[model samples]
Target: METNTQILSTEDLRSQEYFLNMGPQHPATHGVLRLLLTMDGEIVKNIEPDLGYIHRGIEKMVEYDTYRQIIHVTDRLDYLSSHMNNEAVALAIEKALEVEVSDRIKVIRTMMDELTRIASHLLWWGVMGMDIGALTTFMYAFRDREMINEIMEKTTGARLTMSYNIPGGVMFDLHPDFVKDVKAFIPHMRKVLPEYDRLLTGNIIFQRRMKGVGYLSAEDAISHGASGPVARGSGVRCDIRKKAPYSAYDRVEFDEIIETGGDNLARYQVRMREMYESLNILEQLVDNIPEGPYQMPMRTLIKLPKGEFYQRVETARGEFGVFIVSDGKKNPYRVKFRSPGFSNLNALIQAGRGVKLADLVAIMSTFDFVIPDIDR
Candidate 1:
């Protein structure tokens, strides 16, 4: 028998690059984010994020709303960090008015802010696990997060978007059980958080997926304006609470978490350690809540002076800044929010470059952004 051989052409051997759309309807996105991906085989070559699916013109809406009503608009920007968002706007307004909130209000706000941070991180932890195929972590994360929701509902009358912070101070006094519940949570979280390490952090599979993936450096993080865990993962010290304290954060002593690895694992570890620091903050203030009115008596209408005012707060995801140009009007002349998600999202393309398509999900999860914050 005669032997026959076949030769392949260059075109037959070449791998064709293709484009893929990840969302506007994908679970991995966590929102209506649309990512246009260019891929060569399994490796990602480019990422273009198409935003505005959920944009409600929050900044424009704030211009028509009063100072007191502005906080509510900010609520929908990052529902998970609503309390901190509200505080940012309230602080800006208060600064414009030159009014001092009571120490009691400050203490309660600080505690509530920490609670919000922990709650947001809980969701991030669970979703991150789910993104990487560890389903059990989803259940365990929500178990502890529910406790914080209950605690928040009791005080703010809403679990996610509290709308609790107002121009002068908070909406209402802390629930009678606020201190007791927070104290209880501190112990419970300390116990529950360690289980997270065992379930996912130490798992060989998870370690392999996260350890060297989605690497970003301190210089890139700074140039891209990343914040919160995204920046800290790259050894960038950008925690607003530590760098520039607002809303009783100056009174608390806590370590700023930083990781030099600049990988997915580094980001994960940053958030994990942050939860403990939040616990530390709660411990220091739980028993020390001062006795005073939660809100100051305000005139029916709030009129800020004709000047620009800015306030920044450390939210669960990153720095949430509110800037207002008053023009001595009932409503702000111009309203702008410096949301962390937008800046963090800008870095995704850089980080996702050359990473596997599957690993992109893990990379984004580690960034831990709330999409509406960017959409706004």
Candidate 2:
């Protein structure tokens, strides 16, 4: 629903173009994103993101560390859903080694990954709402997020950056209470997510602010390699978890939530739908926790073969792929992190072409980026 503002003035600064930078620090721009806005007065002409504020030398850091020790650093890459980072790296290594991950480990990994997805979406819902002037939804969103984080900590010993998943298997064995607690969380999240409809989706103010704002066409989103919510927002059913199933995704049943409009409101709707999808996946996986060994014991001098291996997992943000080129050594010869935010950020430059300055922030939050994901 593009706003049908009547053509009042034909030449109010449409005759002249001016340039303005939106931020590396604007809260609404999300994280450390500086937008170089070329504008004809309030209407935007172009946007270029000046990224790399949060670079931490993560790719270089992995070269020196043992394969066993590298999962900790993966957590730092996407701090929002660190477990997925840990699992992505671990899966790549496991694939390279051709090691058999146990059924128990596989199910647990799938369960945790879905949980991380929910938690990430929950946080995104809050901050995105706040970015557009809805504060109460943030609190409501975090309330469930806190429960998920606490469940994570109970199993992995740390809430946020839990380096729980590892190469051969998990760093720690599953907690004895993991089953009951996760099952409890499933119903709780089920009860709470519907409240989102009342709090944000159904609100008149939010619908007006978002509805048709920052629309991305399906072809444009695909051309840019946008994944997760960004891709799904455009009705692109491209969840890597389903496309290339790794880590037990093949064993679970879930749909990639998608919408056609690709607007700010559509993105909000997609994530809102995703919280339920994740809960659906959780309920399916939680009941069938397999009983088997968690991890196989790796030799002290574990070495990757002299070939390149790629593993792409669907993280909360998007497709997180780790391309590891191992030269038959303890260290990878080259490492590539296909960070989702970086690919999704390309959408900002593409879609910002003819939007208004005030609408820029609304558009940016739809991508749900963290700067380090781009910089790393």
Candidate 3:
């Protein structure tokens, strides 16, 4: 008696490529973002970010709103970077109108900008750890972040979307305790940041998950227009604050954190180090805040000349730019926003290729995306 048997070919044993949808409503995404991932078994072959779930048509709305009104809408784009978003629009409007804000206003804006950076980074740090299976980090991060939120509420009357930065200057003067609160927070944060290093950064498990994963080269970073920690992690000097000084950034001394590793770990290190740099910027400004009016005198209706204007600022994510086309009207004839999240998300298509599905979560966390910013 003989048995009939057949051996499988190499191609027959191999797996076929398939598609997976990560989210428009997944926890790791951090917002309403859908990632259409092409998968070859457990490895990601390509990633297409499906946006617009949270798009509010902010740019189109701004065209109908006054320059002052435009400031408020920008806050909704990158709510974590709301202050910086407001500043971008305000700076563009001021540039179009040829208004120079006072030195005091400049200093206050810079200090607040740094505080916002710290707060945003804190949130990202905690969330990133949580994304990779460390829940304790979320609690610790929010603990420090609350202090900054309280400070924002006291001064700007809002925590998430302050809309504090107006066209001419900030909407109001700093709270009487602003400097004292910031001064106290700096020391507290400096002490606690190291704890974060011990808790997550040095974890052997985390290191294994991050190191050498999702490599994005410096040249690719530039070609993809990646900025903030995403670019800096790859050793690209794309910090708008350093390259083109705006507000009181020129008055401060702080190093732009750069890591040449071009991996997920490098991005993580860049942000972690950036928190220290933001603290340095705050220490220099908090005590030395000048004595002057918080806001410049401006016409009730701000009308830009019949021309175009653009301003870019370094936000928590990266370059946040506002461009306006005016037909000599109180409202802009056309409006556009250059948001960092959109560019950074696009770069993932390259960095994420050939990475594991699990590693995709780690790589995306490093991006620190705000979905509305991408969709808008």
Candidate 4:
């Protein structure tokens, strides 16, 4: 028997690059998002995020929705940051109408914002650990997160996408037990937060996986318009709460968490530290909640003056802005949302280059994307 012998060129024997689809249904993606990745074996050479898997035409839909009704639509954009999303649209409408809400409204909105931030961070922390193989962190995180959800449910009558915030102020006043429950949650979170650090932040294996992975420099972060923890991780001072204070954030004193490491670890550290700051914010405001009408009185048919209006708020993930063009009608002529997830995902494409496939998951966990926010 004669066997056929053939020689192959060096180029022909080299490994070939190929494309891989990561999501639209993957657990690590956290939502309905698909990432088109170009890979050379285990290394990710390029990443192009394919979004809109969950698009609901929220922006265009708002054009037909009354100003009051639009608040609920914003809730679905970044469901985790629902309160902040509500506040953004409410604030823009208030700005357009030139209606200054009561001090009570401002303080309550601010407190609720912090609560939402803590809840969002808690879920992210839990999911991040699970993505990296630590399953226990999920239970620990949800345990604390349930406390906040309970508080919100009591006040807003809805847990997740609570459209408690309306254009003028809020749908209703805080629950009678709202302050007490929040105050109780503060200390509990303070005690348990350190446990989180011990469980995941200090884990050597976690650190080795995340510390130097997915590096995004400050310049690149700003160029890509990354905000919230993603930009802060790279030492960018882009906190809208600090730069432009709205709702009672100007009254609170808390350090803006910033980490200069410019890596997945740095991003993780920023959010971890932010949880403490959220607690600090809640501590400062829970007891000092002002007394007055939770919502301001407005015409039954609310119509913004014909012009352009814009408002920005610091949500759990980053800066969330709402821009509205009104035609002096109850509904807006056009509306747009400046969602943080989209910008942070843009930054991810830069940070993810050159990282291994496994490391990409950790980096994405650090980014903490909410798919609807990006797709919207």
Candidate 5:
């Protein structure tokens, strides 16, 4: 037996590496983020995130604004979790002032935080499907999200950038229809979530696209300071709600969803399971909402005692921390926010490398980051 084989020349094997700009205007980047990706064919060799496209110098602005005025500014950072962001500042102020709000306010704050979380997750779910080519999921997700949005609007009087939380309490009491609508929507969500699962979660294509893709280990997640579903998916127990209870979170019974898979599918599952946990929390507290004034009387001019105070809350994306330094004045001497998206985005370069170009979308989607939050 005789066989002949021909080898290719060096010039035939040479390949040029090229860069692809994901956005300062692309849909997948989600909010003016530009990702400069280095690629070898379809495999991603490196990722460099170019931020500050939407930077507003929020921290510098906070120095001149009064304590009360700072509440509104926080909403713009992560508009999807506006209420929670407001809560972080409010809680910090309360601690500085030695103010413990009434039970009614605590319960209401907890309810609103959960609602914000669910709404954020729903939006992420819709946009995630759209990124992956399932346009129908977007429609279904928004349809249900509108119901929650209406509930928020009725109580807070603003949709996305709702400045609902105030120092010592919420700005207003729950609306008359608030409990009723939430009660109705709970069962509705219970019904619709399964449909969402059937429509996409179980789809073989989605599973293949997500499972074992964008893998991050527990060590890497911690090193990157990832939190919420991003950290939870990699088996990191870094939930602020469970670890350090604020408002009425100490009184609620809900599991911190954890997945050890450390892939896109794992992150997806963590958020999906969290929705049910949020519903469970609402079910327990909606009927038992104590009757009391939503807020306490405050002086027209708000000032914090000279010192530094810090507070952290579990937002839909992750742990949002607020650090305030006051000099016994109406305005803070300095203010800083340890934004979750900024820390989580740092993990992108690590997880995205070595994965296929398309898998990067799944990885970024799993992070569910808001660019304004990162830019801030």
Candidate 6:
């Protein structure tokens, strides 16, 4: 025994360990993200991210595109729910240009943003459950996701890439069938979610796998810049939409979901409760999208006025900020996006340490990463 201990010293553990690359094309990765991990059997000894492979210099791409052209680019960043990305960019541009949008447009954007929130959470629930070993819930969650996607496709040219949001307003008015479709979705969504509870939320196997797994304390969660469900799970009540109301959010009322556990289950609960809260916000604003022209018609190009414009919006991931420096020209002198996922990913080194290889997937799913959002 003494001889074996001498042979397998700390130096041996460090030297003989293997480094594994889990993504960039791994099947479980929701997008183009890659996780470089150092492992020892079931435990992850260390993990580091090597980003920029997916970078399209989206920030650079926006400089030449007219403000309208920028909307299309936002679609590809976090394509799971493009409406949220579109809202972040549109709100930023509107604040920068000092443009006044109609009340109807504000209501429309808020409702759409909340819908995006629900859709995004649904997809996360599905993917996270799959990671932790519950396959049926993933299918059930996607069934509900398809409903929201149909709503998106009807209004926008594509379901996954919504160029629906524009600078001063949305690209198209609420469709004639909008109200009826929304009303039908209300009960349909409510009914569909309980099965998720029966299949995954309350299931013993899922609880065993997720509950108390991947714990991240509040201090570390904030210090590392965690956001969205991950931050909220760690007892942070920082929702940008509530703290900094934009569009018609101030006009609507909704609860912020929070959990003290800071575990995989806590993150799951935040997202699950958020879906219900989103439903409440949508119920209030869906029927009241007033009559108005959709996109702000501008034959002229960007022509941003001098000085700078800075704005933040609560995305499905968290607070997304856009900073624009304009020289009173059609092009921005500089454009910088303080993307939410970029900071959230920083916390992974802490949250992921000493976790099981399988639980690593759940930890990452909680981050809800969108690679292009970070790469951009």
Every candidate's lDDT: 0.91, 0.84, 0.91, 0.92, 0.93, 0.82
lDDT by residue for model 1 (1-376), tens? 5333323444555788999999989989999999999998889999999999999988888789888888888889988899999999989888888899999989988999999999999999999999989999999999999999999999889988899998888888888998889888999999988989988899999999999999998888889888989999999999999888887889999999999999999999999999999999999998888888889988879999899989999999888898899888798899989999999998888899999989999999999878899999
Q: Which stretches of candidate 4 lie over 4 Å from their true place?
A: 1-13
lDDT of 6 at 361: 83
Model 5 vs. true fold: TM: 0.97
Range of the 10 consecutive residues with the lowest summed lDDT in candidate 2: 4-13
Clashes of 4: 0
- RMSD value for candidate 6: 2.8
For candidate 2, the per-residue lDDT at 283 reads: 88
| Candidate 5, position 38, lDDT | 95
As a whole number from 0 to 100, the lDDT of residue 238 in candidate 3 is 89
**Which candidate comes out best when scored by lDDT?**
5
lDDT of 6 by residue, 48-145 (tens): 98888789988887787666677788788777667877887787778777788888888888888888888888888888877667787778888888
TM-score of 4: 0.96
RMSD to native, candidate 1: 2.7
Q: TM per model?
A: 0.96, 0.95, 0.97, 0.96, 0.97, 0.93
Residue pairs in collision within model 6: 303-330
Cα error, candidate 5, residue 230 (Å)? 0.3
Give per-residue CA lDDT, model 5, range 16-78, as digits (tens).
Answer: 899999999988888999999999888899999999999999999999999999999999999
Residue-level lDDT tens digits of model 3 in 253-292: 9998999999999999999999999999998888888898
Cα RMSD, each candidate: 2.7, 3.3, 2.8, 3.7, 2.1, 2.8
Question: Please, what are the lDDT tens digits per residue for candidate 4 over residues 71-168?
Answer: 88888999998999999998998999899999999999998898999999999999999999999999999999999999999999999999988878
Least accurate stretch of 10 residues (summed lDDT) in model 6?
293-302
| Model 6 TM-score on a 0 to 1 scale | 0.93
